[model samples]
Target: MSDSEETYKSIAVLGIGTVAAPLIEAGLLANNASVLVITRPSPKARQIPEGAHHAAIDYTDVSALTAAFRKHSVEVVVSTVNHEALDVQPAVAEAAKKAGVKLFVPSEYGLPSAGHTEGVLLVKSRFVDSLVAAGLPYARLYVGGFIEWIPYLFAINETGKFNIIGEGKAPATFTAISDIAGFLAYVLTHLPPSQLHNVSFRIQGERKTPRELAALYGDKAPLVEISEFPPSVKDGAFRKFLQVAFNAGFASTGYDAAEGKDDEKRAGSSNSLWPGHQWKTVKEVLNL
Candidate 1:
């Protein structure tokens, strides 16, 4: 396809949560693309982003979803639905296929999920499988952990304690929320279908160990290493699992050392895809 024909002009973004908000902003800033934000019907008012179209429909109702896509002339469907509501995606994918949408971007803005067997990751992996079953092309973005959440993940509270899991030497990837949103919008409106479809774009704003991150807080925060989470920490089990995953090298965007040679090798970091954009780092995010 010619450069003029490669880009998708109309896009419908599902859910306007943490990641979706900036995506809508970026799409609107693209100038050439029309952004449509889709949400589930609710009595509570939603602050629809200015200059973007809004639609509230029953996700289970394929007909309603299909109609919305057609009404907007939506060429791509980007699902930012949170993990708890991910089950609705198969229905959304069906609607996208029926509407002849060109692409579907699944909500996988966290760690690498291709080989997960249990929990939310499993549900995410299965959703991708459903997309394949429906014959819908997709682009999966693996961006490790969000930079803003690092404080919570590290158990840094209002007090001056920094809880470190294990040795805190394992390398982990982190990306700013704005960077993720900007990258998604940039690629969807710029890359050709050939590059967007069925691709896993692994990106990272910075790679740092837990110790390195803790030091950024300066001497005011004292580091305390422990094998298990203290009772003070909420969601102890899940938090413990995350620490273990990090220590085992599973927290990065792509393949890690813990996964043996037999495991699938993920594509390398694709940050270069968006040329000249300076990714935000942890120090910059923390104002250090």
Candidate 2:
């Protein structure tokens, strides 16, 4: 893996074990990018698109990760590894920065970080900051809540019931997994610059009310009424310090009311990234 050998066509994925499978498939589908899949002691592993490079190495070792980047001549680094896989994003970003990778996509395929109001996303905000400081072009794609999978995630199905915020009437957005990979690969191949691309998308699924969703589950779903607890606030000269303790916390009653004005302006995944390109709605996905 000499400096002279890199032709600049490779896209190195730091963790291929978790969600990289679909991303790699999508990247390879793009036809212009070469894939370099990296794993721990890189396994003989599962199937990926043909012509992609595979490496099983010690990612814990910064030098090992760097060497793989150089070996593949990767211009883009997709960080699909689990948070534990790369405990320190700054480290990976530093490696990507040094490797001169033109673009980096961190593992942020969940709900959009910016859209959250309850500070449910406080942890994610920190990671995005780290990516920005790394000094490479990054795209953070937000798929509003997962429409079909949250049941499994929250173990709602086990109880034959689910919990949601307020009257269950809020029209929150949700995105399909396949669509996420497609959108991400499309954006990565079309990297713009050092800025983080922020866009939220939802599947073309009908925005069914919670009752409607629960009804679909039949007797399994209780005739339950779910209510959203408004974002609580604390009144303090030191808002940050007092918030550390929930008992000391008192929500600013007016805050949630003020924020409520924009409740209806839901932003689904916009295919504007690829103008003239159409997206598949949930109906099409379910063959309805």
Candidate 3:
């Protein structure tokens, strides 16, 4: 696909916090996409990245957000705010619809929310629903687990004390925040007629088992297996424990670095943003 900066002009990044801030920064660097940041009117507003338009926003008021979108003439809306997705996401969708924002990217930066069955309505899912219901042009990148959260949560790099269950060897999905934004930039710039889609474009840097990772660094650090119960009796089970976590939302999984279709097309993209652009590896991200 032809990835030309002319495709995206004014872009609004909702909640310039955490990974989204850097993602927007990276996009602004490589491409000429002008960024519009939506931030709460607070002392923290200064944290929004430079080289873009910034607006103080209160997510609780959809009308106010709608005004920001219209005032900025935002062509694309990207939501990056986390934790409060239930309230913020739906509000963003509503405001975008009212303001006639052409494209919307929800806060789903991981597994496909489409497969979850028991959700009365997770925050992200609710915002996703608003996107569908609003009929706003939307796309999501499903780049598996965030490697940043793994080591601490699993106590990797050291082993004596960890919450690891089952053979960590089961291949799992993961995507660095940087990579996710790169791929997401590609999609938002090249979304098709499916205004909404059930399929998620997945990616990952590595998929080694706990045993493999343990073996690699276990001798160098303290590694302790957390559970020894039978798979049937375990809370999430083993053998395919990682897969279950992804499915059940206990741990991140659901996608891997498998050989398949190119990363450019989610539903259909005539011009891909990162066709030949080589992406960073998990190894490189780890080192960084």
Query: Could you tell me the lDDT of residue 10 within candidate 1?
Result: 92
Better of 1 and 3 by TM-score: 1
Per-model tally of clashing residue pairs: 0, 10, 12
- For model 2, how does the per-residue alpha-carbon lDDT over 1-288 read when each residue is reduced to its tens digit? 454333335688767643577777765446477888776763355565676787776666677777778777777777776534446556677777777777676666654454233443445555666666755666555554344554542235454555443344444444566666766676555534422243223222234444455555556545443332123322222222222211111111111222432232344434456556565544455332
What is candidate 3's lDDT per residue for 1-288, written digit by digit as tens? Answer: 343333667789887766677777776545667788877788743776668888887876898898888988887887877644546677677888899887777777655455344442245555566667777767666555676655644554333344456545445455567767776665555444342243345555455454554455444545565554334333333323444453333333342223321232332231134577555544566653
Can you tell me which runs of candidate 2 are displaced by over 4 Å? 1-9, 42-47, 83-86, 115-120, 153-156, 162-166, 190-209, 215-266, 275-288
Q: Judge candidate 2 at residue 263 and give its lDDT.
A: 31
**TM per model?**
0.91, 0.69, 0.75
Looking at model 1, residue 233 earns an lDDT score of: 79
Report the candidate with higher lDDT, 1 versus 2.
1
**What order do candidates take by lDDT, descending?**
1, 3, 2
Ten residues in sequence with the least summed lDDT for candidate 2: 246-255
Give each prediction's root-mean-square deviation over alpha carbons: 2.6, 8.8, 6.4
Give the whole-model CA lDDT for all candidates, comma-separated. 0.82, 0.53, 0.59
Candidate 3 has an lDDT of: 0.59
Where does candidate 1 stray beyond 4 Å?
A: 3-5, 256-268
| TM-score of predicted structure 1 | 0.91
lDDT of 1: 0.82
